[model samples]
Target: MVDAHETFVIIGGGLAGAKAAETLRAEGFTGRVIIIGDERDHPYERPPLSKGYLAGSKERDSVFVHPPAWYAQAEIELHLGEPAVDINRETRSVTLGDGTTIQYDALLLATGAEPRRLDVPGTRLAGVHHLRRLAHADQLRGMLTRLGRENGQLVVAGAGWIGLEVAAAARHYGAEVTVIEPNPSPLHGVLGPEMGGLFTQLHAEHGVRFHFGSGITEILGQDGQVLAVRTDDGEEHPAHGVLVAIGAAPRTALAASAGLEIDPATGGVSVDAALRTADPAIFAAGDAAAFWHPTLGTRLRVEHWANALNGGPAAARSMLGQEVSYDRLPYFFSDQYELGMEYSGWAPPGSYDQVVCRGDVGKPEFIAFWLKEGRVLAGMNVNVWDVTDRIQQLIRNGTTVDAERLADPTTPLPE
Candidate 1:
């Protein structure tokens, strides 16, 4: 049992840190808990920043995980805009950016990640932007609203979730968007070919142009303003503004400098099943921690909102000496140009021998199941959310269902 005065220091005031503090209090720890984040605002949801928040449909406070007053009520001290500059494992203390060190009985490193910058010339121009923070989204929204054309051309440099979601928001404002992907289709590197094909056709139907198999060599600009994007094919595409969404790397400098073990394979901090690092006094979670998956038998690092919110409490329990392990059934959702897509479970590499499609793909309403050696590996639902619950259950129980029944469209995947 922990004493009431034992101080718990949590770095990174994102979803994971906030939830950890809440969980500690809920479990009757009553220790002095503090959350330190680099962002000035209260911890907010990143998913909305690309979708509703970027579309001007919501306010800044709408994305906050909890209001400012909530922190005071919970007695969880929040060090907003203050980042942990250094860590002393021997002393068990964390030095803040303002040059103050705090001792702690336990520490949670949820520093999250920053936007990966592009290396090409003219990337430093004014109109070139990356959406990772709420402030960034606000600036992007203003830029899009200022463009003021019914079919304004907005060029996206990557086809990741953030890029696609921003494209959907731009299209909502009647902007003619072009997505330039190095791959043949969106999400090809992550979801494979067939699933990415569905997204390609879906966007094309909504009047979004795709420049597939093309790489941006340079982002040319005039007078500190982005003017056009030049591809490796020597074709210059006119773009009012360019968005780089090439993904992010783990922010592990503080922990690494403290002599923490980082996994070379995933570039994430190595954590045990209990979310603890090499030092039992320290732990990590969210986008910065990588753990081995029991099902896939490979290290997994998921960058999704579900992982932060769900995995946060699990890490908190482990830090409090509870034996809970964070082996969640992974799930992610994406919205693009009026299409809703969701996926669950780890899709093993080269696992699917047969893919059964239920319902019509052309109508934009269907579900596809990947079967590996007569067992379910992963499933994707387009507009069908009814069967997702059952599909999730089937995945949990490792139930094998009839492949023929899956294709009938009338009968969903069995539970």
Candidate 2:
């Protein structure tokens, strides 16, 4: 293991970066650790950006991983608001945006992603927004305070998790919300058509109108402010503003610049089972890194919060010379309106032979378990936390389960 006196430089100050630093300290590493991030604020939690926080149910300071004083107390040098521009592998150093070079014996890249913008006319208008950072949330919060409910309509350009959550938050603030999805259902691409239909109905019940199976042609605006959005179906919907949350692409410019292997498919930095990139001295985690899963025999790039928190510590262990590989079950959750949805594991694309759904999707409580060749591959839970957590444990332990028992909600998961 590298000595505590050795220097470690981490790029990005998001969840993964913060966790790595904390883990390193907990592991008794008193090394010179420096964290660099373009965002000025201390590392903060982001899951609330779409839920209670966006709904104004939680304070902004409550999401911080550590207050400004904690980083100073912990002696973790935080280079806030500074972006790393280049990496010199030969010299074992990284260059910041301000042309300062920091030498490091080990490096970690946890640079997260940015929101994907809608490419169309009037996208540059004053009222067009994309939710990805604290600044974006603050801007939208300001608009919410200005509008105050009636006659305040917001157009969401996608029906993905972020888009849907933002719409739900806007609705909570008494703003009329409309979602336009290019697919047949809001979450069709992520959860398949059958399950996506469940969410579509849920949103409709919450007074959020959906215009699916259509594409946006342009964002219409007046006096540099958003007024309406037009779709390819020749339908025009009035809007006070627009939010584009189609998805995200990895922030892998630093890795690519350092000549690390970039996955062509995911456009993210490719790492091994040990979370180490091509350079032995450097490691990566979170949304920006793609790793191969042993069970599926396929590469997976997770953008979920759980993956980052779990993978961050695992990466730090490997960086500390522990022979550990990050192989935890991938899980994600979303709060839409009044519904809670949680999903775990991965179902190979088009591999699930049957889907067993329990409870009534109409009653706002149900769970769907995906099975392939009689093995539980993945499960989606809506307002069902016990079964979700139980099934997650079963899957992690590789327990054999009866299909009938899984399908029937009457039988509890076996101990």
Candidate 3:
């Protein structure tokens, strides 16, 4: 049990860390709270980096999790640009990058994840970039704006959410864009082929070209600047800039170095239902935590915004010796061009037996549900507004539904 005067330290000043700090104060903890971050900027929302921020529709201050004054007002020490390098479990202390050591009664690791980089040659070129931080997005936005003026091509590697969103923003800036994905279709692994095909058609309508079933063998460049990309098939595509959005790897080195249990499958800190790590004094949240999900009956790590937002408070409550379960339905949303979408619940690959669609796919607006044994496991609504609550309720209820009624738009979801 932690004393009222003991210090609580949090690593990684992203949304999860910020939210955790907020929860601690809100819960009336009088102990000192400190947030350490590697980046110079304060905690900020990352979702806008690929959407409004990249498109220049949102200002720099709009992305911050809280204004600069909030941390000081809350009496939370902000350790900006200083990363936690080592964790000493025996001493219950953490060593910062600057070699300062701080003792903690309780610690939260919300280290988050970093973007995976393409290992191809010329990745070091001036025109090549990856989107994981505000600085990266700022650089890409500048490049896209210049490319728009020059009518240059923007070659994006990977057709995942980040890649597609970047492509949409670049297209909106009037830059010619091409997305390269090794998968057969965009988001095929998550949404399945049918819904993935809809995204393909949507991008095609906006004049975005796709190179499917192909991997980038090399990034061609001249004079330290990217010029084009060479695919495995020996085809060269023009490129004034390149955005690599393959995926993200969890930031688990600190947890692993501390001899904490790490999930080898997901490269995340292994945690129980309460988000407590193997060490009683330590806990993890957000992207770095592979937590046991009671509903799914398995361990899973989510990188979505909602998970961090909700998980922070849950982790804090648990740390305060309150009974808590961080098992809310995993939810996420994305916006590209004119289309907006929200997905809820867990539908692991190959776990669902069938998919039922409500509304017309041709209209490019509908809700698709993944089911097993006629029970809804997960659902996604694309370009359809105000139905996410119903979709989540359907999954939560886990009631068997008639396929005919599920497919019929006129039939109410609860019916």
Which one is best on TM-score? 3
Clashes by residue pair, model 1: none
True-structure Cα RMSD, model 3: 1.7
lDDT of 3 at 370: 95
Question: What is the per-residue lDDT of model 3 for residues 125-147, given as tens digits with 9 covering 90 to 100?
Answer: 99999999989988999999999
For 1-415, candidate 1 gives per-residue lDDT tens digits of 3455688889988888888888988988888898989989898888888988888788878998888899889888888898889999889999988998899999998888888888889888887889988889988887777663545578899997888888878877777788999998898776778778888887787778899898899998888888899999998988888889988889989889999989998888888777889899998888898876665566777778888897778788888999976777678888776688888877754757877788888887988777876677778888877666777776666767778876787663552
Best by lDDT: 3
Tens digit per residue, CA lDDT, model 2, 55-143: 89889997788887988787899899989999999999999999999999889889988888777899999888887788788888767
Error of 2 at 15 (Å): 0.4
What do the candidate models score in CA lDDT, each in turn?
0.83, 0.84, 0.92
Residue clash pairs of candidate 2: none
The order by descending lDDT is 3, 2, 1
Winner on lDDT between 1 and 3 is 3
Give the C-alpha lDDT of model 1.
0.83
